[model samples]
Target chain A: MSAMAARSPFRTDGTWLLVGPAVIFLMLFFIYPFGYGFWLSFNPAEGAWSANYQKFFSDEHLWRTLIVTFQLSLPVTILNVGLALPIAFQLRRKTRYQRWVTTLLVIPITLGTVLIAEGMLTYFGPRGWLSQFLQLLHIYDGPIRLTHNFTGVVLSLVISGFPFAFLLTLSYVTGIDPTLARAAATLGAGPWDQFRHIYLPLLAPGLAITFCLAFVQAFSVFPSAVLVGAPSGPTRVISLAAYEAAFEQYDYSMASAVAMIMGFAQLIVVVAVLGLRRGLYRGPVGGGKG
Target chain B: MSAPSERRHWFYSVWSGLLLGLMAFFILNIGLMVAAVVTNSFGRRWLGTWLPEGYTTQWYAAAWKEFQLGDVLWVTAEVVLVVVALSIIIGVPAAYALARRQFRGKQLVMLLFILPLIIPPITYGIPMATVMYQAHLGGTLSGVILSNLVPALPFVILVMTPFIEQIDPTLESAARVFGANTLRIFWHVLIPLLMPGILAASLLVLVRTIAMFELTFLTAGPDSQTLVVALYYAVFAAGVRAPQSVDAMAMVYMAATLVWLLIALRFVNPTQLVSRVKEQPAH
Candidate 1:
């Protein structure tokens, strides 16, 4: 080390003091509770260290909630990301009306899950406007069962999740330099070729990140799964399992166990998506922010 | 990328038209859903009818009286304000430090900030609530504020780091060279430059904390319930009250969020919310 460096207190400088309060706060609140929860999950009220895991895996009813959650979240994530890509791609170019459209789409996100559930129950209910309109128009006279089921929960997820997916995807789509496509066009390449050879590779990493985020948001479905879904039936997601264990049955250890498992499940999907992203083209995300 | 009209193919126009129609249909459904809630909140006895038999504002009055909305709104305001202020106080400095320094274990600190964001709240909310109860802070306003800070603080740091990095570091150095202490430099030189970012972060946090559900829900008590949590309870505890009243309550919650959301949008782009995911270290 140089004599100047040896004498200077780089690590203990006053600048580092700026970060001290936040680090201490996170340790006391965030990391400490996470570690404490992990330890607590193992030491159940009465049983062996592995009892919660044993019970969770062995009981078909308990473990099945994990599968149910995956069923809901996976599809919702795919749907949100898939639908968002096309729309966002189309809207990638700067326009006078773009902000207004984005703002309109953001309403569902600001409205939160509970409001969406409440709105779904009334608007998509059997006696709701949708049913009456369909019946009057003779589009389909059969019964319309949207609420109190898996489908209702999916609808709520889409309403809330789509805007998020759309915005993120829009940012990615807009980041690509449009001139690349135009350059390809000048070389006699068609739109499909330009997109396939250029845009797709650049978009892959962003899409993977988008998918992971959307999946994580959808995976922890609590309020919608209850308000608009059959809580005891198809929509008994993992978060619901944890909520019931903690709040309903008053078992904090079991709840922590369930919550840990929930985090583990989300981590698996995120890891898989990010791992996939590793192989994709990684250039500067924005093409000069044009 | 807009092609000249004469050069645009007919097929392309048709496809664009179809896409426009689809967008309209989706927005229409969302509009109808919100309209349905607003209509139901004011409607009288009507079932299986295109319109309600009549409309009245009694439900709003009933919801206000029965749900103790006054208390809920007050609690929501307190929680949102305190969380915003605390997050800013703690987050801005950390953001500045991270932006300006190259310390050991920087990746670990970045990871610490990112985890709370990518990990869904329910996963940590349960454990945090458990610890809060153990500490005798659960079911209180403080617990709600603390739990919310977990996400809000990281958010402020992530958003502000980029902002801080954009500011020329020489400004700080110049202030120091003039014999100004750290506090003096921050107060006079940095704060003015950081005011825009601070405003944007606080506004976004305000909107988020008002709408945050899982954290506040897991930690709050009857008296500490925010509007969103209270709205959840109003719907969750079924058969004890009128649906219209609950809808009315939902409307009130929507209005609160909508007002802040509009104000937030004026200051911050909506896309900036999740675009920070791109800022994660590539390693």
Candidate 2:
């Protein structure tokens, strides 16, 4: 390929010419923006100082918002992974039902967060069918108030995020050789024993990676928060707080601070999850090394 | 012994049933969302019912006439086309080099490509907007196209790398040995074989660029507003002059995206598109 490109009438330097411009383009657009964000986080305005950082830490609402962000993220991550595992296993069987289910599940990924929130409003919201049915049954008298609260926000996050986790887990599960499970079964292992001994251990790494990926995705929740309702009580995630600070309050300094904190928190969580996975691998290998 | 085998069979059946049940639940959840979107688009303001009381094509009509949906659709198509074309022009060769050639800073180059995927858009948008504004690119179609290159470039490279790697080097060597020269080899040999990957990458880039909201929202001005940005403004800033209008606009947006996705789907392999780019040594 290199030799062919060198001899081409389009010029031998085609590769460099084609690749260099895009690389430089990304450097200017992607790299510079990231560096600028980091610099803004520290500089806080005209001078190089930690005032934004200090203020972010000192402000009570910042901490509360951070906690709320975690509150929304942690549970959604757990639920998405928990739900994805069984679906992934069944998908490995490759039944006709699995194909239809996989296609149906992927619809949300294509649907933007705004659209998903809108759908939730019409279907799961107070005035929507779910609430109406509950009321008709006398389970509740008033609107269910699913939107504008922790439950609504988390549910939105979970619904939107579950597909991604499930797809990733499904791919990982399918990648594992089925022979291992069959071997375990033939060795007089019960179904539960075969799963616990052969399957879960192999799946642990993929699950850990999926957990972090899902957490990052859920952590960056934005349009859903705004469209569903402002993250006031339990829904006010860090991204919402950052956007509000920057756009609504016109406090770029504070906004940058919140964004920095959010990024840092996500990095920590990802690193910790990855670290735990590494720790798992470094442990004494049981009878099943593969 | 027979009793124990029967009991085990029953347990497995129940377990499989539960798995199938969960799968059904997931399918129903998504099915309901799609149904709600379609129904709400045409449904009369049906309160206190599982299904709409009445349906009409009025929303579609209003979307086309009152909303200026055609203009917004054109803008979205134009942006996606330019972004995808520019990305392919820049990405395919770079991916070929990264995959087929050994060079310095290869790892760093690959890392730089993947950077956009790592950082959240919110982190990049503010500074990107600020930079683009200073560069006189902000609020223009050019600005949106340029900012979009960050994600599009990485995606193309990631998708194209593996495709390029899978191309056997022997064919290129044979072309060279026959004195066909390099450009001829690339044009006749490499490009044709890599057509599927390129098409897939182009389609993926187009789909992504059209659906993008945050970067366009931050960088695009009123004059250059894409469909998604327009929909956002209509929903949030412009009070639904008619609530049904919002539904109409959303239906248009969804239909437009689905069409683009379907068109793009024909050119790309779904499995290969999702994986990231990794460098392999050339023999």
Candidate 3:
């Protein structure tokens, strides 16, 4: 598409003109507001530049959101990517069930977090079908308490995140040429060895990417945390804390600061995982990696 | 040697079966959860029970009036259509530029397009809302539509770029060589080829903005509320909330989203976006 010799009706300046509108739009709407938020975080309503920062750091309840967010995000990311790996590996090859499973998994992405939370409130709640069925079997003495706690929030994240993780990892895994694995087997490598030496190394970068994405998605836990999880307790993740600060408390300064903190936390993990990709299989995957 | 290999084969089979079983359970649980919400919206008495005692459509009526969903749906339609129209108008040219022309700062531009997608909206939504308030757009239809355009435009660009790239450049050149002008080529030559991509991108924009709870929630006035945001208020707002009414509203949201998604999926693969981002050069 970008070959030097290929001619277009427009000049190079015309090409630049084509790209201008989008960049200008984002600069106005996305970048400017984001910069404004970061700047606003430093100046609070009643104090110096660091007032909101100090307020947040001093208030243990307020600052703990960073930790709570990560606590749930890390596990959810691991579980989603971990579970998605083998399933994607198995379903990478075309099968009768593959398309159906993929579509079923993607049901949540379209369904949205708010709707999933709504569903979980009914099916996973105490005395709901899951609990009642378990009770009928005498598997437990009490109703299955799935909501209003850490379990509920984690379930919500996985329900939404797993499909995402699977879709991304399936693309990554299947992107690799299967002939590499077959070649390894022909050379006396078994499934275990083949996966360890070939698939793991090749899949590392994609896994890192998938993990970061899922983590970011999980870290921004809001509607589900408030709806299904204990928003005042176990699932008071960072986004909820920010929402409370801005809308509930009407402290835009403090809310801006918390939002910056949330972005910073996500950035740290994203940078770390992105760095990990350097040590993975760096050669072009299919051409030379096998 | 043969014995060890045979045992390993046995273990692999068992593990494969376990993995398959886990996927089946995951699918079944989500299916039942969806069924629960759908059924409960109409259930007469589902409290403390595995199944509803009876069902009725009265909740749907109650939900429609109680939530004032008719107006919300209208507002949602307005916001979605404007956002889609704006995103396409802004994004298609950019996609063409990125696909066809080499330039400096292109990588920077690419990264900028993705940042909104990667960084959660809540981080930016609050300040954007504050700006909207300062500018007196916060509680209006324009504000919600503007806030939504931030993500929706870039999304259109990202989806459309690959589509633009896949088109044979020679076709454009052929149209040009045939003396067709820019607008003439775009309308007569490029648009027909680009129609599927444009349709997919715009449909996704519609789906996304409707499901976009955070940005719209932050900026919407009472008169400007979208369905997902309205559903959120129904459950979480301070009052004695009816669980069934909330469920019913959620079903409405679900129906709207599902219909658009089913249509969009007909044109694009779910993995399409992920693969496009992966293929895009970051710098």
Candidate 4:
């Protein structure tokens, strides 16, 4: 025990040897590329001052995708967070099914957006299962409009986002001791009352954080939008705009500009959400600080 | 918390029922969609019907032939294996240094790891692709591997840090007192102790790398495309392939990921991930 003070306060030698490889690799590939992208956005090939940014903002079509992207992302964020809260609340008990239930709910997260899009096209397509079931029940005469539009994109986002939201929400919900709720109950706090006064305040910070995360995820959506939604129509989000600008239009600067816009939009909303969290009644941080 | 003596409002029961219904709806939705894909892949003809008319194995065979899936699967394996192996070699030691050491700039380094994770890959993928293209490395397999390594290595470090932190340092010190050098101690003492953590971390990296699309989509050449990228082309590219074949290809991608997912789940609970564990689940 006395020798503990004799050892170097930090680590034995070879600490750099351990951490150096990751630092070098990420600095070159991840950090450098990011800085390069930012630099490239500002320094365009044969352009005037901030031409790409100006061009992106000036073009009505390119900038509008930001609005369109938000429209889709906001609702999906609300639905995912809103739905996740109650479900996570309900599942906070130490029931035997908790492990399996949590595992099953998060299955879609592993499935990825592309696979979900594939499933949606089949289950929601004109000749897909949902349409056939509805038709057989005489719900409508014509085929249902599912994919190739806003509806399919939102649905896919929820399918992917809800699980993640639930996981976060559950961790927050479980972090609070059940005894607190019981204490509130003995004091005549009903479920709604307990939730509003106790759970909501504590969960608010986590919820705000969760919404920001889910919103960013939906905001950056590209695969599902292209795979299941009409790219030329209502579902033309910013990522797609960026992809086209880079890959299709062969305009790297414009693409980087759009990409920067996407990152900025996400950052603004995240900061706002976090700002709201700051003003709220902060509850105890629990679970894994995951 | 359920109280038998308490009387509940009618609305409470209905609310509880609705919540249950929502969970059921999601479960059924996921199951039905997966079932639809699986069945459609095997169905001989799936027109406007609740179930496919009949089933066969032809589509799997057809998808394999039409998509050049043999090559695609080979590429997928190559990319996933290289990323996982390299991530471990680099990340585990970093995790060790982090778990055992306290030093200046440690918090900053941790935040650096978190940044790649919190930010969407597309925000950075485009720029990376631009750099690769300019350097004539964009379409190469090495480019794809390096780009994917950005997130994978950070993920490895973050996940392994906690795992390493849990093991006692005294054991390593005891080994050191016995005259074991760094290499011998790491091989004989540290490796066995860290084996489970290593397995979980590796499997997670494998699953993640296989399903990762954004970076791979950006950097992969035609020959280096993984199955997910190939599936995207099969759907959106200049082709009018059979629906069954596409479904089969999607199924293959799904299976490839799901198997690794299942194995990873066995080693690590997904719930225990993304956040550190404060308490284990109560039975």
Taking all chains together, each candidate's TM-score versus the true structure is 0.94, 0.89, 0.93, 0.94
As for TM-score, the candidate ahead, 1 or 2, is: 1
| Residue B70 lDDT, candidate 4, scale 0-100 | 100
Write down the worst ten-residue block by lDDT for model 2 chain A. A281-290
Q: Is candidate 1 or candidate 4 better by lDDT?
A: 1
Task: Tell me the tens digit of each residue's lDDT in model 2 across A1-290.
Answer: 34453464335445565568867888889878667767777877654488887877778777777888787889889999998887687567656665566565655766667667767766776667678778889999888988766777777887788887887787677667676777666667766676677768888877887898888888887777766766565666777777777768766666767777888899999999989888877544333333
TM-score result, candidate 3: 0.93
Write one digit per residue (lDDT tens) for candidate 1, span B1-283: 5433225568767866786677778889999999999999999976889888999999999999999999999999999999999999989989987888766556788888888888888999999999999999999999999999999999999988988887898998998899998789779998999898899889888988999999999999989999999999998875699989999999999999999888877777778655563332211
DockQ for all models, in order? 0.58, 0.36, 0.50, 0.56
Clashing pairs in 4: A288-B276, A290-B274, A290-B275
Q: lDDT tens string, model 3, B12-49?
A: 88988999999999999999998888888999988777
User: lDDT by residue for model 1 over A141-259, one digit each (tens)?
Assistant: 97699989999999999999998999999888877778887777777666557668777778887788899989999999999999999999899989998988899998999999999
lDDT of 1 at A243: 88
Judging by DockQ against the true structure, name the best candidate: 1
Which stretches of model 1 miss by more than 4 angstroms? A1-12, A279-290, B3-11, B277-283
Residue-pair clash count for candidate 2? 7
Candidate order by DockQ, highest to lowest? 1, 4, 3, 2
In candidate 4, what are the lDDT values of residues A179-271, reduced to their tens digit? Answer: 777777877777777788878876777788788878888999999999889889699999999999899988888788888889999999999
- Tens digits of per-residue lDDT, candidate 3, A1-290, equal 45542555255647767789999988888888889889889989998999988987788788887788889999899999999999898787766688788777767887788888888887888867888888889998697889889999999999999999999999887777777777777678877787788888888877888888888889998888988888887788889888888888988888889988888889999998888677545765434232
Candidate 4 local lDDT, B1-283, one digit each (tens): 6544345789878997899788888889899999999999999988887788888999999999999999999999999999999999999988887888765556777877778888888888998898889888898898888888899999989888877777788998999999987778778988898898889889888988888888899999999999889988887752499888999999999999989888888888676544444444211
TM-score (chain B) of candidate 4: 0.93
